[model samples]
Target chain A: MNLKRTTLIPLDDDSLAESIFKSFIEKEMMLLMVIIGDTDTIREAIPKADNLAQLSYFKMERWVLWVRNYEILSETLKKHLKASDADKSKEDYNNIKCLCFSPILDKVDGIILKNAELSYASLQQSFFKAQAHDALAVNI
Target chain B: MYYLKRISTLVLVCFTIGIQAQIISVIENDKDQKRTISLTDKQIVDINSSLEIQLSKLQLLDAIQQQFPQLKQHLELESKLIKLQQALRNQSAVISILEKQLATASEQATFFEIMNGFLTDIQNDPLLNERYNDLMAKFFSTDTFAPGTVPEPYIFSNLNNDMLQIEQELASLEADIYAVSVLAFKKDSSGGDRVHIQNYDTYTNRDYVTIKRWVTSLSTEQKQQLEALNDIAKQNNLKKTNVFNELKIKLLEEFKSITCIKDFKNNSIEFINNIQLNDVVPTEVKNKIEQLNLLITRFETLFLLLKTDMDQWQITLLLDIKSEVETIVTLLKTIDTNFSDVTTLINQTRVKTKFMPLVSEFNTCYATINKDFETLKQGAALLFNLQNNYIANKAIGTEVLAFTLDNLPDKGYINLKGTGQRKNGDELLIELVLRLPSAVENAPEQVVTIEQREFIMQLTGPRSEVAIGLIFANPINKEDLNLQNDRNFFYTPSAALLLKFGSNKSHFYNDFLDFGIGLNFATPDFNTDGTPEFGTGIITTAFKNIISAGVNYNLTLDSFYWFFGVNLPFNLPGIPINNIKN
Candidate 1:
């Protein structure tokens, strides 16, 4: 099943944002996210993400956002849906999710999710892998 | 006392006689002694010669005394004859001088008389007066003649020459009039005029050519007037033709150049400008061109505005397409039908907040384009209407000009026919219309019709081909017809035959005044009673023809029936026929 979701991340936590992006890529999930912060931090984060994957990135100082491993994301969605269904998938997702980022929670608005099962599976798998690795290290 | 005076007188006389005799004897004795004493042989011869000379002198004296009375009478007669001859020579010389003066005075008077006639004609005609004034202004300081402001010698010479030519022409005209008068007199004396009066039945007809030849002789001024009128008419025709032709050519050229809407607008503007620039163009045509230009300008402005609106709308459409493509690409990449990723994309790009305004702008642009299109359509239609009107008016003007030129009056009658349905059941029509030229230029044109004073006879029957009627209309009005005052207005009136044809019963009147015959055919109808019944009526109308009065009679037959009526025709004095001959 095709999975699409929008979630907010804190502005100061670069590691978490990077971790979230890497985890989504490993799971072959499409991750489009907005970073609400100062221009210097967003600008620094854009290059790090560019080195990791070929993606669409917009540098709006007021609202900075980036996409990573977009080709893999398209392949994953195509594999799950029929050709006709895939044609309208982008428009449907745009209709559901907000395309702006804000620093304040009140200004954040709501996160939108499409095909939530894949998003939940990708997140759960990532946590389990981390836990497994930790148990192995402790046993050694 | 008488006897004594006689006796003394007798005594005085005797004493005086005796003394005279004695003195005579002494004087004779002294003369004989003197003569004898002076005598010699030679002296005696000389004395004898002297005595003989003296005797001859006395004889000559006696003869002179006898012839003196006859000689004196002859001398007196000779002196009187010489005086009378001198007086005769003086009188002859005076007569010759007076005759020359009279001839010169007569010539000057004739010239002035002819000039006066010309001035009178000019005064009567506004156009001619204007031309005359213009011509006079060229030669004189003022149009009015003033004493001591004599024209240049050459001007006078030219005028004199022209006057002389006119004098000769007038003399020729007078001679012709005299010739015709002589002919008329001869005809009268030869019993031709009497024959017409005494034996009217035998006088078949007056030869129109001969009569016309006699009557149509024009005076010099009249000939000149006709020539001037013809010249004016020709010039007017030329002006009208030139103006219309130029307009037609210009319009055609403009139409040819107008391909696109822009070209149409530009070319139309140029055409209008060209027309405006032309001084020779008629005012109505100029006004029409101006109207056309206004319409074209409006059309161009509206069309350009519409195009600009469409351009904006198209740009907005392209932008919307780009946005749509971006949205589709995002969806393909993210597989997010719920649009959560798209919302996030929009949030990251900061484009989401601007979408509603963009959509509103697109809507506004589309609406503007539509409104502009509507305005352009209306403007285009208005422009088309102006063009059509201009073309139609041009056609009408061209036709009128052509007709005026082609149908300039010749020596013949023009017939015009018109028909109309009356509000009341009858048909008002001109069946056989006759229009005669006023016989001279500057006279009002008039038409002869049945509405004029006339006599009519009709034969009507249901079985007849048509309800046939005969009409003899009186002469046209003197003012309108321009008939000569000297002409006898009384003549056999012109005749026409009216035949009603077809179901609506249209009347077709054919003139037979020139002895031309015509026939019309129509299907016969039966009366409602199944019998062949005929119905007839008479009505009079005025202003349909030249002013006048009339009477009518009709005979209708079932087998045979008669109907009759009288109609009076009159004209309102000031009103004229709407369409008169040119």
Candidate 2:
């Protein structure tokens, strides 16, 4: 699959990334959005971005992470997973919450998103490159 | 409104009244002796009930006459009932005519047999038989049809026509009022208003698909067990279809095996919720399903909180889930899976959502309708009970069927006309019949009945009487001796007012040997020239007041005198014997 990257400016605020989400649909792509950042600004923007995302099997898929403290968030999530798995009533096996952040987005702050150059002539930055690669993998 | 009630008792009391231990006073004709009647308990009950029924009819009629004067409107209402009956009768008559015609047409359906009879006669004659055989040989052929397989349902041969033509037309018709006139109680009518049942949108007819969520996680111990389980699975040639359950069972053998949280997986939550629980879905039910699905999703996260020992929100969510599930379960259970109509669906939809209130509503509707129906039923019962008679509100007459008598006391002359019958030469039965006008239920009542009283009676006879008289004094008085011999005695008026007793049956004081004392007014014969002055005196009565000889002394006259007379209202002298014969 050929990979392409898309960059979103004005990301350092508690505002919905409507333009980016709309762009994915305009570019004739599956409606998938994965927001990744480790900042207070990113944490506050989760609900703001969530308002724009239609959460339904027939609608769109959303994977968001507003990592305040990476260790605390990861441990908290792991603890939940461990405890929930122990609970038979939860039946969490089918409700597999995908923690997909391996070869795609990294623990970059909102400043990186704001500082990333709009490479109109070139392909994209590495972070954008990784997002495009993730998007392409989803398309395949 | 209750004018007709208990008219039976009124009729009974009018004639034979039982005073002592079921003994009835029945006056019968000596020769005819209509019926030797004894009032048995059952017979009394029957008579009372029948009389009550009869009298209720009469009373209703009278009440309808007096209270409801809308006779013309009532007759108009009756016209509807008459029309209904007429229509039924007319329909029956038409059906009868149709049946007769149908029977006639049935007999005419043997035309083929009639033709065969002629053909048989021809064949019986020898000369014709030869021609008939020749013709049969020429015309008659094999009884086989064209060779083709019969259709699965070859019904053409079974469609035998009756060939009886029946034509019907309306010769005469009456379509005005008689065609239809019906009366029935309806809501929001002239008398009072009634409400219509409401239609709720959530009364679903479709069965909702259940949404289930599954949890999957693994611990280090379960992961270690998975290798052996996988080996076992490979030995059994097991796959996802069969081995998952075994794997799950194996995983659960150890505690804290977060490896496999469940043995089953159903990822149809999003499928059903998106496709089915949509726009056309029953809104309230849809909302509940959506809310429940939301809670199940929330429980997944809440489970995390519960395990993490964040107690507050988890407990609330669990309680909410339990309550909401109970509500939905009860509601769904009440739904009839096979309801034939919308009414049943709505009724079922209004399940025990709020257990107390909903059940109370059902009971309320039932009780209200029941009470109203009972009222209407009582009214209809009353109307039907009024079969053929009208009881009277007021009854007045001079005489009735019978009279009873009591034995008189022996004190003095009672100044009454009494007839007594001595039974077995021991007990006396006095027939106290009077030819005076009588009344019942307050209509100027008068019963001139004199109980067999003693010889002596109170002067007022249980009712007050003021007596007045014209009197003449004798000349033996010292004051009157000074007057001329011709004017020695003077004409004067006398009067008395007496307080009476024994008037009511309850008062037995002076009941038999009756006596009365009262003050009187008379003349003071002081002037010797035949003029007298009037003054007061004291008076008394005796001998049942039968011989009321007026020999009273005058308190005003201050003299002793002799006189014979009567009267408070009118004065008459010299006519003795206290006569009240009128």
Query: TM-score: which candidate is best?
Result: 2
TM-score of the A chain in candidate 2? Answer: 0.26
lDDT of 2: 0.30
Q: Give candidate 1 regions above 4 Å deviation.
A: A1-140, B1-110, B117-301, B304-582
Identify the runs in model 2 with alpha carbons over 4 angstroms from their true place. Answer: A1-140, B1-464, B475-480, B486-490, B503-514, B524-531, B542-558, B562-582
Candidate 2, residue B292: the lDDT equals 40
Q: Report model 1's interface C-alpha RMSD after superposition on the true interface residues.
A: 65.2
State residue B108's C-alpha deviation in candidate 2, in Å: 90
Per-residue lDDT tens digits of candidate 1, residues B196-234? 111111222222111011122247985796688769858
Best by lDDT: 2
- Tens-place lDDT digits, model 2, residues B1-582: 355556766767754433222212222121223222233311111000000000111222233334335443432333222322222223333233323423232222222122223333333334333433333322222352222221101211211110011001111221111111001111111221111101101111211211111112235875676577668747753443234334223322321321111110022144334535345434554455444445434533443443343122221123333333334333322321211122233244533232233334334433443443344334323322221111110121111222111111111111011111111012111212122233343223343222221111111123455544454444347555354445654555565565444321222334333454555567655554455566554566543333233344545445555543333333347543233321
Q: How many angstroms is residue A54 displaced in model 1 relative to the true structure, after the best TM-score fit? A: 99
